[model samples]
Target: MRNSRRNFLQQLAVSAAAMPFLTFEQQAYTPVPHNRQGRVLRVALMGLGGYATRVAEAMQSCKRAKITGLISGTPAKIKEWQAKYNIPEKNCYNYETFDQVKDNPDIDAVYVITPNGLHHDQVIRIARAGKHVICEKPMAINAREGQEMVDACREAGVKLLVGYRMHFEPNTLEVIRMRSAGEFGKIMFFQGLSGFKIGDPTQWRLDKTLAGGGAMMDIGIYSINGSRYMVGEDPIWVTAQETKTDEVKFKAGVDETIQFQLGFPGGAVASCLSTYNMNYLDRFFMTGEKGFVEMQPSTGYGPIKGRTHQGALAQPHVMHQTLQMDGMAEIILDDSQPVVPVDGLEGLKDLKIIDAIYAACATGQRQKLSL
Candidate 1:
């Protein structure tokens, strides 16, 4: 038994040492900028789905945030998550009863990770319950719904944040930093391709009533939101075209694929494609007058690899969700500003663009955007 334990420890040490590709020589010990002693943001996860599971697990590495409570419709899932996260029974609630969280002091905020259709109603109720809300992307089905959520939180005197995890990624931020510093001079064009051959026809994402739309609602919003932040300007106009190869599966109001274009105020144009019938399509490329950036596997879970005219982006990979939760913790608890805005207004802008895209597709004409 002693020998086996010693061998296991040695293997673990070897794996740890092999993780980082580059390492600095030990000299003066320097700590990263984090206040471990500060107040922790106790967040209640409102959904126990796959993404919520990922966020809850990643938050275990956060210094300033924790999963203090859980909200799920399934009692079995709540019980399972409670045992996994060491959550007290009082800190758990179902969708039908989460309004009681208003009296639960342990939960400072609730992250609504439910489906797109459920965000608007759930966020508004959480705000009225006197708790801050961190809603997942596409804040709502349309700009009108998104605005209502924003107004509800505002009237209730609470914060409403969007779950844009990419905003805090180290590599993505490094590219944005370069653009702000004039390294990528006068950006001219961007291309975002986000898609995957989806599975399961009975899933809610394939239902127009539940998902609000098709690929545009579920995956296309990435390019829509990514264009604004990458180009550093709100779009003035949008033109979109839709294609449906499997009408039987896609059904009415659910799109199979979409190709859209966004015209920025600075004359920068973005050409993007969102689909549910293709794979190996996750990529983003932006070119400026002086230099350019390219990223493949851009919006996936980890190791978003990319390069630019200068050289490869050198920022080491950190768990994107880990950085996102910690950054959100600072924003909620310490009022820290983010490099990229993740507020309800920011989310509303994306919804406005989405409305325009869908309109353009339906009318077969260019839609003018004011956001």
Candidate 2:
């Protein structure tokens, strides 16, 4: 038994020495300005999917963020991004070869824009490589996977940021500011409707294995996340009802539409809907004692229209992805925290609520959420 333990320790020591960045170097890392110029946070795109393409294009408008590396399973896609983004061959990687990214100095972080189910493994791999990770919404299939990803990144001394783009939007932040400033005068209720007519019935998003759930996992998460931020409190209980209009399209285990009610500790209540069959139905409404705030097309890609009982929100419009990348760059390189957090724990809270909502729907009872 002693010999076995000694051998295991020796192997662990060898692995640690092999991966130098896995040391306590990240703990000692302080936000150092590169020069008189702004800090640069070099990022690598892991998946070359549609969302990844959008993020790469928007990253061009970011001052402190640069696409310095590419990681994709497709060789042709990697070649295209390398040429288009001016990424050197050495900085490019495939999924199987991505672990070697720790040896490269130019890449500072990996953005995991893969499917919902793939986030857990890919994010852990990025942390093991000693790089920060920015995973897209629905951080993982469930809270268990999400927590594991969080623990992996924490152990690695790396940051795990979720791609909650709405958290960085100017108008949304303004509304949050108003609520914090007592403009809302004690929040009471919030309503979030997030859904779209999903295309391609055969896509992986409809697959339970890859997506973990149906419409709720894909677009419904926006409503869940929005409610938490708008209410400024975590939910204590959830009661949900799910409906499926098209069994063939949505599948048995997946949800086509779900209406959920969340009860908060401060007596605030949130009613939300997540669906795939609905069209042009992205909106959020928050009503308080003093006033109310409403946003139409709230979670869309751009030009989020919003207004309160006070007046029109005159906040300037910027691309959501652009603002999100720039804000994330500051968080990474400057050690700055955003007015609205987009960290892994923040993502975990949403996932936990999702788990409870699913349970509530299954049992036809109000589910308790300890988050």
Candidate 3:
């Protein structure tokens, strides 16, 4: 055993010597500036699912970014996107060959839109490829995995951004601005309800192993996120109750509905419900000492509308996803911070809350957040 350990150490030392030293200057990862003068950011889409397709369209409208590479498991989908996006045949890559993308100077970043379970591996791989990463929501199965991805990106000197569309929406941003500007006096409470009747039993969303959890992991995340933004602070503690309507339907790890409450730092409280057994009621309501702000159907695909106690907001009139993509491009290229918080840290906070929620549900007791 001693000899084997020594051999392993010697091999590791030799490998370390073979690798180039990473200096402080070499460690700096410069973002592409938003100006039109520089080269356009060449992005690669790692998954060709529905969300990936929508992101591709949004990228087309970005003046500073474009899809230059495609990675997909399905050969048919690869051929289709290659033709649609005018991606060169040489730039197309399968799952096995995706690591080779590190050598392709044309690809500066990668977007991972795979299933929830696949996010951790894909993000780590992309970060190792020395490319910036944009990942779909939930970030990972849990906070631990999310932190791993973040650490990997930081170590690789790459930028990591989560796909949080509402952070970039005009109406949502206005609400945040109003709250921060004291339009709403001394915020008091927040209420969020996000649910959808998921009909497909065979869908990956219903599978516990693939999805990590049920409605909470899927549509329920919107509630978790809405509460954080609406309250304008991370929750100090969480209490939750869960109900499984049909064990046969929801399965062992699947939850049909969950009611969770959050206690914020400044004596604020948020009540939220997330489910897969109900109709769409995605909304966010925040009440302050002055009045209230409400967003009906807040966390959906497009055309999110809202009004504050002051009055109706002036809509920017664009797809929420589109705005998010453009904003991400600006952050990557222009070194801009999002007006509303949507960084990896923000996403990680949400995941921490999620961890608490799951624990509360299991124990039937309130759980305090450590961070």
Worst 10 residues of 3 by lDDT: 22-31
How many steric clashes between backbone atoms does each model show? 0, 0, 2
TM-score sort, best first:
1, 2, 3
lDDT of 2: 0.86
Looking at candidate 2, the ten consecutive residues that score lowest on lDDT are: 23-32
lDDT string for model 1 (312-337, tens) is 87677778889898888887777765
lDDT of 3 at 162: 90
> Cα RMSD (Å) between model 2 and the true structure?
11.7
What ranges in model 2 sit over 4 Å off? 1-38
TM for every model, in the order presented, reads 0.90, 0.90, 0.89
Better of 1 and 3 by lDDT: 1
Regions more than 4 Å wrong, model 3:
1-36
Clash pairs, model 3 backbone: 32-333, 33-333
* Clashes in predicted model 1: 0
lDDT of 2 by residue, 218-247 (tens): 899998989887877788999999998899
What are the clashing pairs of model 2?
A: none
List where candidate 1 sits over 4 angstroms from the true fold: 1-33
lDDT of each: 0.85, 0.86, 0.80
